[model samples]
Target: MTQDELKRLVGQAAADYVKQHVPEGSVIGVGTGSTANCFIDAIAADRARYRGAVSSSEASTERLRGHGIEVFDLNQIDSLPVYVDGADEINALGHMVKGGGGALTREKIVASVAMTFVCVVDASKRVPVLGLFPLPVEVIPMAQASVARALTAMGGTPQARVRADGSPYVTDNGCTILDVRGLQILDPVAFETSVNQIPGVVTVGLFAQRGADLCLMGTTAGVEMTDYRN
Candidate 1:
């Protein structure tokens, strides 16, 4: 199947999984990106089934609003019952590499507040280890150079991510992204912490120790569940 076709299958499976697990009247945490868009579309198709949605990006909020799904600000909600998102790359352990869409900071915050984090992805995205995909690090524009130096120290080659218009890619939070290449991450949690500790670093795309509770992996046959909560 083509990439778009595969993404659609996985996205549908993910939406179906959420509909099955999420209880009515619960505040849902919605993630950003193409796959998450699919989930939003599915949920919107059945608007009355959900109470409200907490979006991780402005773009997501607009999409949900367009469907009449009540969108709540993160500060407005104390906690989210579930957070459903897609990853650029995910491993068997549920560790993920995200931020291709520049919403990593918000995605991480929402996932952190959620009771359960559900990752949805196509089979092609599954990897034995993380880091094959360039890791994204959100940094303060003022400290971009310093943060880039720190990433190099960590054995990665850092490059500024740009938009299609050739301008620096700016995130929803108005931060910049440093795409780090090279380096196999052995301990994701430690790496995440280390990167965050750097001055001017907002958040890293490496979701190491804060792994997902469940995974909805789409395969050629259909979607398969990988339950890690047990």
Candidate 2:
């Protein structure tokens, strides 16, 4: 199957998983991106089964609302049963590099409050290490240069993310993204913590500190589920 088909397969599987695991009338957390968009469409068939959703990005929020699913603000919701999202890349340890679409900050925030993070991705996203994909780091616009310097000191190439039109890619939080490359994140937790301490850095796209609790990997064969907590 093609990659898009694989994404759809996992998306359906995630919707099924949610129905089985999350209780009725519970508000779940939704993620951003194409794969996550597929999940939104699949889950829409059973929209009434859940109370509503807390979306990770404005795009996802619009999509959720378009499907007649109510979207709730994070502050209004205390906890989430599950956060279903896609990962740019994932390792055996469930570590992920997200935010290719520039929603890292919000995605991380929503994931933090969830009881379980259900990462849905295609087989190609599975990797032996976590740094192959450019690590997206959200930073204040004025501090972009300083943050880049700090990232360079850490032995990586930090390039300011830009759009097709050549303008800077601004995130939902109104900050710019620095896509860092060339560092093998052997210790994700430490790497995440250290980068977060850098001044002007809002948050890195590393999901190691609170990585995925479960991963639904889509393959040509079918969806493979792994519970990291186990």
Candidate 3:
């Protein structure tokens, strides 16, 4: 199957899994990115199964709403049982590199509150280690270059994210992203902690600390379920 076909399969699998597992009226946490968009489209079929969703990005929010799924504010909701999203790269340990959509901070926040985090991805996304994909670091606008310098000292190539128009790409939180490349993250948890300590860094894209509870990886055969929580 093609990449988009694989993503659609995994997205449907995620929706099926949640509809069968999550409570009838529970609220959910949704994530960002293209794969996550597939999940959003999939979940629309069972929109009434859950109350609504707390979205990680405005793009996801709009997509969710377009699907007729009610999008709720995180502050208004106390508990999120399931957070379903996609990863840029994931390993056997379930560590992931996300935020390609510039929604890292909110994704972290929503995922933090969820009881379970499910990552949906195509098979190509699986990797031996994190960091093959450029790790995105959301930083305050004024500190963008400074944080890039700090990332450089850490032995990574940092580039400020820009739009198609060559303007700076501002995140939903009004921050800019630095896409750092070339550092092989052998220890994702430690690296996450260390990068978060940078003054201008709002949040790193590493999802190690609250990694996937499970992953629905779409291969040519089918959607293969991997349970990390086990």
Candidate 4:
């Protein structure tokens, strides 16, 4: 099957998993990117079953609203039973390199509140170790250079993310993204915490601190569900 087909299969699996597990009237935390978009489309059929969604990115929020699903502000929601998103890379330990779309800050925030985080991705995204994909780090615009230097000192090459127009890409939070490459991350939690301590850094792409509780990996055979907590 094509990669897109595989992504769609896992997206549907994630939707089905949410429907079967999350209780009725619960607010879901939705994430960004193409795979998450596929999941949003799949879940549209079951929209009425849940209260609404707390979206991690403006793009996902717009998509959810387009489907006539109400999106509640995260600040207002007391409980978020489930959060679904895609990963750029995921290790066996469930740590992820996310924010390829530059939504790390909000994704982390939404995931923090969710009781269950369900990561949906195609099998190609599964990696023995994270960091092959350049890890995204959001930073304050003025501190971009400073943060880049700090990231470089950490043994990675940090490049400022730019748009197709050759202009700096700005995130939803009015920050910039530094795509850091190099370095095989063997220790996820420690690396995550260390990067987060940089003065200008908003948030690193690492999701290890509160990694995926479950992962739905799509392959030609079928979707393989792994509960990381086990």
lDDT of 4 by residue, 66-178 (tens): 99999999989997999999999999989999999989999999999999999999999999988899999999999999999998999999999999999999999999999
Query: Candidate 4 at 204: error in angstroms?
Result: 0.2
Instruction: Residues 1-230, candidate 1: write the lDDT tens digits.
Output: 66666667767776777778888777899999888998888787778888889999999999999999999888999888889999999887888999998999999999999998989888888988788899999999999999999999999999999988998898888899999999688788888899999999999998876878898877778778898878
Across residues 122-216, which tens digit of lDDT does each residue of candidate 2 receive? Answer: 99999998899999999999999999999999989999999999998988889999999998999999999999999999999999999999999
- TM-scores, all candidates, are 0.96, 0.99, 0.98, 0.99
Model 2 C-alpha RMSD to native: 0.6
Question: Which of candidates 1 and 3 reaches a greater lDDT?
Answer: 3
Candidate 1 lDDT (Cα, 0 to 1):
0.88
Q: Name the regions of candidate 2 deviating beyond 4 angstroms.
A: none
Give the Cα-based TM-score of candidate 1 against the true structure: 0.96
Local distance difference test, each candidate: 0.88, 0.96, 0.93, 0.95
Cα shift from native, residue 138, model 4 (Å):
0.4
The model with the greater lDDT, 2 or 3, is 2
lDDT of 3 by residue, 17-117 (tens): 99889989888999998889899998888898878999999899999999888999999999898999998999999999998888999999999999999
Q: Name the better of 1 and 2 by lDDT.
A: 2
Q: Which residue segments of model 3 deviate by more than 4 Å? A: none
